[model samples]
Target: MLRPILFIFVLFFFKYTYGQNEIYELRVYEMEFFKPANILHDYFEKALIPALNREGVNNVGAFEESGETLPKKIYLLISYQNMQAHQDVTDALKNDTQFKLDAQTYWETPSEKTPFKRIESIFIRSVSGFPNLDKPADDSEFFELRIYESHNEDALRRKVKMFNDSEFAIFNDVGLNTVFFGENISGNQMPCLTYLLAFKNKEEHEKAWSKFGPHPEWQRIVKLEEYKNAMNDISRIFLKPLTYSQL
Candidate 1:
């Protein structure tokens, strides 16, 4: 092998089999509060995103809650390259002096424009074995969307583990392919889990769900006391990706 290909090959074959190849998932959930909407848009554009970008945040943008007449909360799904990248990005923010200053400036500046209401943000990593995640989502076409919310921290972490652990195979076995999975971490609400499952289209999404809900393994897993108590509300919504999301 040539030097360049050999280098690339080591980066690939030696990296974990999956998400490490090209997937790093980060999802955000926000409660819809009128006072902070514009402030949020401005904050991301002017304050938060710059710091986040420096830390390797990708697909960073806010979106409205979809398929609703009167939407109550929104979410942002951000991607990274790997667990180490995710860890470094988050850890960098904690240690970054400029980020600390910017955060204070962001909150203080926003306080002048609008009042703040606390919202939850959690981050989760995606599990392997869901289909069609062979490349980065450069085109924005996806079909199955899934979100799981737990009411507390311990339970939320457990939910994250279930998706991250071997249990995630149930989704693949039932024909539900995952697009991206991550917990919310920026929007500020606590004890909530937000993730997305995208398919090729709406019909495929519906079929996937049909396969997911009634699978025999799922039935058995669903009966587990640990799974049952870990969740309080599980919400799912379909989102249409928009242009200029980086803005």
Candidate 2:
């Protein structure tokens, strides 16, 4: 009993000191050509989201590409309080009788009739500077998801530090509203950091970015020696929230 008490105390101290950073799961579903998207939508709206909310997870985000493309993509973002919460919630779902019943239609659907051809999942940990996901404004209809890939682990570390030390404030000054910023913990991109920005529309998106390039703070930080060569590549995708999206 003493050992268990000590262990619990250590865990509590760790979380309290570290600001309780959240874990984000980003799931991308690539839809089949002829399959209806509504099947997955129904499952998410009527079953998955509700079950997750009951389990104390809320503000789930569902989105799609701003433009139509082959093999349509559906993006889902779920946030967990911590690593332990993520594991516990996942295990609890397996034994959730109501969740099982609600998900019956999805479970009974034939393989060939399934909505997606494949599902890709990426897990991320919130950055120290940005410890939680923020819901976008009511008028925020456009979002940009950006991934910065570094040449190596050290470079990735520097890039993340750059964001923490100066870039986040610069972004705020320039009116580039942030939704979330995180380091990819498990995904295809090994040495990368990902972040999302929200805007009212395309024009607002363009306008906000226009300020970032010429801002005095940005100009000064971009020339900082420590951050030089911190990133080698960037991938940007524009997304729009689905009708049922919570963020």
Candidate 3:
């Protein structure tokens, strides 16, 4: 009887702990030009994404920066159940035979013919207020990726606090549909947080921000002394999902 009771307690504890949040990996691949971009796209569509799916990661999102631009880039958002799963999937990829065979074309490309100049990877832990990544609707056409940079760790904490305590609520009130809100656990941009928002079109994107600025809750939170100057700089990028993107 005692053994059964102890087993039940342990099961409940593990479920509560691991079910609390998801981990996200954001990968950015910078291309030198359009020609090489195709190679990267092919590899993602044929090799990497399928391999991830086999490993139980089902919600991989692939996106390209919007508009006609030179020196293109691709963004991939992959979600995991936990930190352990993230590590395990990565380790498995390194030695997976089928993945290697599938990715052979990309692997065999010469240095001169390589598709991307470099890849930037950032790991994020889901915020408590928004613990899971939301999958965008099938008809969703545009995404706005925003990164808020804080001056110091204290300011970063406060900015994140403001989001948890009030801003996320106001965002929902104003029609800023969130995809994910994550604190950067490891990345180039220190003392910052990154989030993704989805919209149906450019017109809708513009209209949402218009509503957000003057919303009462957002106004009140911004005026708070503790939250003042929490963000030093902001970076915004508009993206359109690739045909195969799962987000």
Candidate 4:
């Protein structure tokens, strides 16, 4: 009730506090493996990594989703606190001789077609008030956050059934505010599944978890032998809006 009002108030207050500059960070999704993921990984390590720093790019790292659990097993996180600052690299790319050469070898290789095979990018704006809302689901959570790094196609279908059971069971039994849940979609380098929680704000995210954790129903679910190993590695990150985000 009060949260929506607060979000609006904060949006306006924070908007002008920085003098109309809105910040956003792009979560670049590099989907599909480049024939040989190892080679592409090496290219990023050798070329893209140093180039980003030399070009004054902010934060860059890759999160490998557990291929054993999901078909989509890669997640890469790139950060930019200010959008206008983007020109620093684009400008450098125009003038940097060494960077240009590295770029050509890394990206424009004759045999290498392209880094991204198919891209499903999503622009996520921070919910001003919820800071750590990105964490995995709690007992009282109306939603479920399950990520999978699959090894084969058959397991993907199995993973889907497991997810539906978990999320649906939570909602039906717990009376929690489970509204929406979906995989984080993108043109990703490593394929993995990601789910977001829709809480009122940061406070409720905490409250829901604390209550959910000890609930008898939740404890029972957690102890189910069938659900013993659902995720390989579940990592969550928060993105602050860069100065360039339109919303």
Q: Best candidate per TM-score, number?
A: 2
Q: Write the per-residue lDDT of candidate 4 for residues 1-247, one digit (tens) a residue.
A: 9999999999897764543322323344455543545545565566665676676553453444322442333443343333454545557667877766765655655454544454444422222222212222322222233345554434443444455655445543443443223333332422444444434445665666666667666677667765555445655533222222111
Superposed model 3: Cα runs more than 4 Å off: 1-20
Write down the TM-score for model 3: 0.93
State each model's CA lDDT, in order: 0.57, 0.91, 0.89, 0.45
- If ranked by TM-score, best first, what sequence of candidates would result? 2, 3, 1, 4
* Winning candidate number (lDDT): 2
**TM-score of candidate 1 versus the correct structure, residues matched by position:** 0.51
TM value for model 2: 0.93
RMSD in Å for all candidates: 7.5, 2.7, 1.9, 13.6
Number of the candidate with higher lDDT, 3 or 4: 3
lDDT of 2: 0.91
For model 3, how does the per-residue alpha-carbon lDDT over 1-247 read when each residue is reduced to its tens digit? 9999999999998886666578899999888764546667789999999999999999799999998766788899999988988899999999999999989998888888887889999998888888888887777899999999999999999999999999889888888999999889899888899999999998988899999999988777778899989989999999999988988
Residue 59 displacement in candidate 4 (angstroms): 3.5
Q: Give each model a TM-score.
A: 0.51, 0.93, 0.93, 0.41
